[model samples]
Target chain A: MAEFWMSEIIKECARQRISLAEYIIRGECENSGSTREQVIEKMGKMLDVMSSAANGGLEAPIRSNSGLTGGAAYQYHQYIGQGSSLLGTVMSSAVEMALSCSEVNAAMGRIVACPTAGSCGIVPAAVLSVGVSHQKSREDMVMALFVATGVGMVIGEHATLAGADGGCQAECGAAASMAAAAVVNLMGGSDEQALHGAAIALKNMLGLVCDPVCGLVEIPCIKRNAIGASTALVSADMALAGVQSYIPFDEVVTAMYAIGKQLPAELRETGRGGLAVTKTGLAMYETLFGTPMSL
Target chain B: MNATYMTGSYSVFDITGPIMVGPSSSHTAGAARLGKIARILAHNSVKKVTFQLFGSFAQTYKGHGTDKALLAGILGLNPWDLGLRDAFSLAEKQNVEYIFEPVTKPTQQGWENYHPNTVRFLITSENGEVFDIVGCSLGGGKVRIISLNGILVNFTGESPILVTRHYDGPGIIAAITSILYQDKVNIGNMRVDRKRHSTTADMYLELDSDVTERVVEEIQKIPGMLNVILLQRINEDQSLNNIE
Candidate 1:
């Protein structure tokens, strides 16, 4: 509550002999002047919004106005239901849900950005998928989301969340880290283990650039949400199984910020470099806008 | 980064901006909110509106639907409004004259005080009332109304904002606060911006809760008070939930 650094968060959790979610709740209560019950109730509404987004995408996949993304979430669901996925129920379903949220976003439907709209799918996909698979109670899931919020708050304070500033690493990358920590907490891992999951997830995703084709939140953005979800699941499993990150969560975040600072402006959501300037990407851009992109 | 963001005063609502219809929060949602603020300033008397976009918005407003988003907002639609897609045609049908002009800036940071996602609205009412406002979309579907009629004023669409234009004099602040106190409405925060050596000033207040129409009427009745308008709350009350 006194500080927002990951180190301070972990220390507060340990010093208070409380779970990470409880520490987050107390801090939120102090910071926002809201009661615990109010915070929990608000979180519940967010969960409902996430659920509705996924369900809407699955029921009838409306193509985004860009026509670049649609039906993939439902298709993924169908593919997962066929039992061909090696990721088992939790991870594969997470991917489907992740796609669902991104597709909904691309279609201009309602969505909650766990950090940013570009990466909205990552946290909801992981939390809802795992919660559904385990039939976890709403209270438990809300607690897990609080843990995720704590991780996100630390990253937002230390690094960045906007793709324009940091790149895809700050968007999808930060969301993946939050999802990983939430997954670990939901699975009954220690608060330290949850932070480790976050570190591992973020360490692996460092330097990822933001390069959506045609300056739209489609193409790489939607699929990347799915990948981000799976990565979070794997990282959370590793931490829950006693794996550790060589770099702590705070250090990993610092590295991400440093790398993001060095990234070319073209690679940081400018849609001028990386995959954005590819021949096909340019072709699609012209077809959509009726003019050639100067890049 | 500003001092407020640094202090970690951001609420949970800010994590993803507000839950709304979105493709790009910075381009669409933020633009709409800016338009909404301009509409409020125009007192819904806007007959003609011209939008000048700069920086990232100028280059990609079409693809991101920033044009439609802003127009929809001036028509009093929020980001979640499904009717945003039809905003252009709706404006024409409503007989609201509008034009969108893209201005090229050498950098996202404009030559002077322009932010990356900046917009200027020149709104003219049917009664010949003109209101010109400049705003910036600070990404994540957040917007800050930076200026009103060339006067430097800062307001983010976070709470119930009361924007008042009044003549500068003693007891101006106390008069407003007294009426608010009588109504049991708390002042979350407030800021006063005045012209140098001038009597005209702007008072921006973020109230703890929504104010009754009568409260605005009372404030308007005060001496030296020129105008009073409530920049309606955009995001719904997520602070308290009825679910037990």
Candidate 2:
């Protein structure tokens, strides 16, 4: 049988008078043939990894193996410590945490792939920053993660998560959408509101291409994660204020997939289009590998 | 929804996790998984290995740390292991020799048909046993073993499996199935491959659950069975250890 759809999940939760997280927990238990405790324990371990990766880069300037991207997260952390962030504490911390996690990923430190490694920073940054600032307990954060997982599964099932296949709209866009849902859930928004948040986040990122400079995840990938966190927070806030998406979440995901398919191969992580082929981008590639960019 | 393209059920962890060390899940993490499975199939006795990388794997393997991750896995390190960064040194310390040969030209006969992110492992054991395994990283840290020892086969590394090399003859398949049925073990999928005019063939059985040592021994006793190896699912719970 096919897995349940987002609409089915929402209807089931409504019919059973249960929260979205509880419904997801039940679905996971049935689908994977694991006990409730086993699923929770696995999620708990994932949360632990996310927590560390969110902080791993801020504590030190960990450079990528290519020596291209590093120390930006640390610098941003120091800037936040100086209280100079234009965004307030919670949002600013989300951006910093997102940068840190992406940097750590570029350094090859361990991370939980929230949809994907390139987009890994967004979900943890959004959930942890908002949850911790509001004094939500660890269980509350884990529940928020379940909400994110639910949204990610729907998008991953219906659309795509790989940049090579669906561009950055699928990776960073899916991540921001998932993070928005988690943030909305953590703030006590209803399931509908959480989905609306996901819709808004994804709608904002439609058509974003996956053109990594030099074919590394270091260049635009790291900074794009920071922007994704900010977008998630804003989308969550909008959702909490009862703002509605013009299109449904599932429809939005389908649109994203269609647009991704329309993108040429050069823009889909090929490093031959968009910002990857800028004069400086090519120079960086040539300098790093002692060869001009090909293919 | 288009159910035609969507067939499998994904766990929450499958959507959110496989907690790993990475810059790219398909390149770094999935490549490591393929190497680890090859190591397990070779009984962890890899003395030398040659990774023939194709297409994307050949072009960007070094940038994505696919090379190090592959070696680390061959040296018995999981994708989440911190030692992945030092995989080259670790392989050297373990006396495991490795080479990365990038097959960039499509003119190489039969090579153009491989996946863009494919790697063929030519692994030699300490006792002189050799294995040829070809695998492809199917994005999101998922992998599939596409070939073994020049015999075409297909299986994702996500399942527990029994792999056998035996002389192709009557009653061999029935004998193996009877043993599994007696042990109450169900085979989820099965594939038998043999080259034309070849007496030796390979059988791959993807199992619903891991088989016991006793069952393996029973299968080993069957006449014409050259070798039987049980490969547990490589992406088990232990690989998700929290980062230190």
Candidate 3:
């Protein structure tokens, strides 16, 4: 039928110029009527859930019958280990699959542009980090999720969340959009600035792809999620600080969708392109699946 | 709530998979969303589903084993498809025909904020009935039920909620509520989805209990709300209730 968001909601910028994070922050300050403490408290609660899940509560879902998505996140949190410790939060919240770079985390997470499992960590990481920094209450995290859910609803309405459907661009890009929009909301962003931040965050990840090595959710999948977590936070900060995308959020999404359509199957979660296609990629595939993936 | 999140039209009652469990939610959940939509579109038995998957979803269908998930869902597997993961082998055993397309263009676009997750299915029956639904599986096992053919419906497994589209009119809400009220169904929270000025709109109501067949029918008869769907509470399908 008709796509949800045929029109752009925020502007898009071609280059990484200005403190887009700060821009978004200012937008939130200007619009959202919520107090700064309200935002901080919500961010804190998100950390509590993540911290608890990361430690040992994941099996509760399996024993209780929660679906795979929630199960995976909780289990992964447990799988990584947890604590009130800073590093533990960073590690568990991050999939850490594999990466070409090792940037020092300033308690910030980047959205790996797109790619679900890996992309999940960004928002959680940022929100939690902010929580710890601000000494906020845990009661607000759930509220933050409600807020995040609304923004996510808008993006989902307007864009794609399928790696195969669009590319890693959609996965990590969408996650970044969610993370940015969510963080901005928590930090007291107005709906206008929040949507604006999301547009910018998504625009940054215009043509990412889903290249899970060996078709497993490890490797780049894990690391990508962490990067996405951090990047989304950065974008959120920029939006709050008054960074503008030049082109609206809707236009960026359209461009991303267009780019996704042009992506080859090899780059779109086939385990045949990007990092999955290198000499190491072939070796990894041979090691795991017992042979090279045929196109 | 922003867009039609669960529209994969084809099988709410297709009998292809053996109790529909999964190796793939695209095959299983996406298929289930379609089946649910089918049930919503036509309260009658579905005849067929022109299931379609583009890009990598098409390429790795066999490996991911989505074919069986689709078959089983058409056959009516609740969310708890233990066999969902092995659906391909099972589908092969059952022999259901499915089509594949590699649309360099994705079914859903503009959501770089999430993942590029979209799967569309065109389900039809031999008796001249057809519908479509699309889904987005946002990583870590989360999925968004996008569009149901054209009847925009949005749902995530959050609550035991039911959403219906009705010809915007007075008394319809009260009439629909009476059916649930008679059934002793507890209304946890309800939101009438209206953008600005409302016409034919959607009503999203979360319930504290499972709806009975009668409740389903009563709400359906409420003059303006066209089709009604009872969305189960989050984790209801694959959760503790099915532990046995």
Candidate 4:
């Protein structure tokens, strides 16, 4: 086992004259003891799952088992189809796709847990929407996924990705960061820009709580994923335009860890505080489970 | 000196996948993996199972589909199987009776201190053998088998393994390792557990690769060996007959 840093990865890529995705692929092959073809084959399968999940709820309205979230993605897609979106085609499709994937997850449809199931929608939405709008090939999308994976691994190593451990900042925030980096790479941004994009996205989401109402991944989780996708796009856009963060990517990750540790258990997916304990949230829980919400 | 972050133990896909039916990775997908591993450990003869949910597993299992996911796995369904959505009916069709018990307080002494996402499975086999196994879903589709039949042990089910029950006696570990050595099967890790003054002990060997049928037969033939079961790595493609 060796230490992995974004700076070292960038330096290695430059020295080898390879792209960030290629460097990650080579390292993954060595780590997993698999061949390049085998690693790519697995990544290809992941892209397929992401594609299906992103499209799962778009064809028709699907309701969550708890009846908490349903048809929002479909409604948004319909709205976009009517040319009513103010965010333009690319950003609108990102939100729509993010909602679709999150809704599908709530409905128990198969999905790739890009970091996690609760935040699964963000990365695929960010990657696939941009890929489709820009006419990137499937290979290009898979490479972008590798880029996301690289960023996620760093987060997982330095901090956490579980809402239970680090709140929504760790789940959706990390997904947005990963998605931002992937988008930068997809748009031909430099490795430094990709890392900067990740930093900006995560910095904006610091201290977000993970208060899933009734402990379900329906209400805030689904909507947050939609917003997460849009945030990733905005961050990537900023990075591509040469915007920079004063704090480096690793420092931001350290700050996120510090902030996460400061969060009380009530805000860490316990359904005991924040929006989960709101009057409406408690009422919904009582209606669904036929029991009063208790700590 | 710079701090290193690469553990080489986790693949990039580990952070990215385990393509599954999802609402929560810890509650749904990891629960399923735990159930499937328990089934394999029981030699797939499970006729009835009682899942005792603790902490987070008890509080949110229903909303997260943890109940259905556990049943689906015991019925031999992979996490990615669409049939997981119909696990209840599928269990009924297969005559697999099930129960879910939520525990807020310790039912017995020494029951405290379990992980927040722990479940203890009480399984009855078709042959009327009853055993209890405890597991924890450590978020992101990762699970650990913490105890089997009251013998405390630990393994992640990420690699091939052999669980054996044998008489507690000298030369037992040596005999098993020698057989594995002759077969050229590398041992990644191993643990042996036994109760004081008991005649029996359980040995768990996590292997880097699958062992051949001949190797299993040779180990089983050893004097004082009671049972030998081989479980494939749960992270890989699996079927009911993964055991020999």
lDDT of each: 0.83, 0.88, 0.52, 0.87
Index of the highest-TM-score prediction: 2
Model 2 lDDT tens row, B85-121? 9998788788999999998777453644667889989
* Candidate 3 Cα misplacement greater than 4 A, ranges: A1-118, B1-244
The digit string of per-residue lDDT tens for model 4 on A30-147 reads 6777888888878888888888989888889999967877999999999998888999788999998999999999999989998899999999999999999999988888998988
Ranked by DockQ from best down, the candidates are 4, 2, 1, 3
* TM-scores, each model vs. reference: 0.87, 0.95, 0.47, 0.94
Question: Model 2 segments beyond 4 Å from truth?
Answer: A1-3, B1-8, B107-112, B239-244
lDDT of 2 by residue, A1-295 (tens): 3355677778767767888898888878777778988888889888889999999988678899788889988999999999898989899899989999999998988999999999999999999899879999888899999999999988888888888889999999999999999999999999999999999999999999999999899889999999999999999999999999989998999999999999999999988998889999999999988899875
Q: What DockQ number belongs to candidate 1?
A: 0.39
Worst 10 residues of 3 chain B by lDDT: B10-19
Best-to-worst lDDT order: 2, 4, 1, 3
Q: Could you list the chain B TM-scores for each candidate? A: 0.79, 0.88, 0.60, 0.86
lDDT string for model 4 (B4-26, tens) is 22433357887788688888888
The DockQ-based CAPRI class assigned to model 4 is medium
For model 2, what fraction of the real interface contacts is kept? 0.63
